[model samples]
Target: MTIPAATASFHGIWPALLTPLKPDLGIDLHRFGLHARALVHAKGCGGVVPFGTTGEGPSFSVDERRDAVDALVGEGVPASQILVSTSCAALPDTLALTRHALAIGAHGCLMMPPFFLKGVSDQGVIDCYRQVIDGAADDRLRLYLYHIPQVSGVGLSRKVVETLKRLYPQTIVGIKDSSGDTAHTLALADAFNETLMVTAGHEPDLPELARRGSTGAVSGLANFMPHVVQRLAGRPDAPNTPHDVSRVRLLLAMLGPYALTPALKGIMAALSGEPGWLRVRAPLVALTTDQMHTLQHALKPIALDVDVD
Candidate 1:
């Protein structure tokens, strides 16, 4: 029995939150809660999404993922403020992940098509979602299709979006297009105006989308600069400030090549005046000593108080 809850309004800055870890690489639920809270309080940030590619969702255990959700809910962050991206490579795992996220007070789920295989058809992708939504069995399990074919090798085509909405109009709520293509994102917005709140994954395109019915962004830029993103994404009437956007881009540039897990931890560690908050799992290596120095030098003028270890 699927419990269907009314879908809530979505469209604003959904930050891909950074997960803090202990030096030995254990989940620091306490710090995780603080980060969630921090973003919620930021100007224009609608809420936080904790398990996107930037959040290292693929690298975490099921328990770790659930615990992250638990921490946020326990901290009094409302479900409306969380859009949990329960993207996993396996159908069963994805279903389990969505179930957990919904159970832990997340209002919606962003699902990437299974990436373990290539050249999958829209039918297969639709079936994967059918299984996940079936397992969720609740009104709160609002599914937002995640489209980033460049990485996932599975793009959510127009047919897939239309078919899913037709099949489960209420259950399938929206989409986050990280395909990095303006044409595709624009097309989705034009096709499904009210039925699906299509959002851009890129920050620069927020205003353009807002004009075209795009409600907001699920942005990597918001991880470190939620306030800036919230300004452009959250405040629709505010005039575009090129200087403001450029400032953020400049600061983000100092973080180095944009493989974010380490740079984010490093920033958190620096700000908190603590050690180990910056430590991350292996296979996602940390900055080298010289690299760290370069980042420090590059980021020096940004005026944050991050310290060296």
Candidate 2:
């Protein structure tokens, strides 16, 4: 399938980076920059997404997030390459974050509907975004609706997306459907196609989604497996290498035994040999000793060169 010129611009792997924490649990800005830089330079990533779900976005204060973005851009990562997820439950915070991203010349903002109020009316969802768009009052802002009902408890209905696009045609550019439902993913791709950039959050569907007109990914796994994702994103017609499928299987195996964030941090620690990499904020703890041992054992096989010691 021919990718639209607009969609093609954003097509490639954008890793949802893991925010490495200091031993005192402070934001490790230097380590964060290193990670983001490595992804772009070494892993050949399209861009880096800071303060998304995998980066523990909700756990940090606005200042912390702002500082992290500062660190990333300060490291010479272009604003055109950084897509910031500014999806706060509060309308004011969301606006503030998005405004900051735009002010810094970020490529765009990935926003989730106000997810604090469960069972919100469709109009309520629409109004929340409307307030931000109108409040921010920036024509330069490119907004991508983030759909991850499983995590956010707020789903981006097709009607909501269509309405936003109809109202703010140029501003509303895309949707990140992390719904992880293939049927829903296909439905969104079929409905929006070139009109709106539909990036699949489900990594495995990337190849098929690419074939069906979906453009790129804002993937968590891409943080650790950027080259694997690069290969996966190569072309829809290409076959999945054995390495790709096995790597994905290895990641999935970790999910059942631990929370994804901690597991990912644990794996990152194994790769970087930095114990502080395992620290997480309150309400999210480090992996258990047994889990770490097991994760190291399991990861060694998949990440052959990584020192799991």
Winning candidate number (lDDT) = 2
lDDT tens digits by residue: candidate 2, 73-107 = 89878888899989887888889899999899998
Q: Mark the regions of model 1 whose C-alpha exceeds 4 Å error after superposition.
A: 1-8, 42-44, 236-240, 248-258, 270-277, 300-309
The Cα error of candidate 2 at residue 274, in Å, is 1.6
**Which lDDT values do the candidates have, in the order given?**
0.74, 0.81
Find the candidate with the highest TM-score and give its number: 2
- In candidate 2, position 252 carries an lDDT of 72
Q: How much does candidate 2 score in TM-score?
A: 0.94
For candidate 1, lDDT tens digit of each residue in 154-227? 89888888889898888888788888797888788778766778788766667667777665678876756666
My TM-score estimates for the predictions, one after another, are 0.87, 0.94
Candidate 2 residue 220 Cα shift, in angstroms, is 0.7
lDDT (Cα, 0-100) at 232 in candidate 1: 65
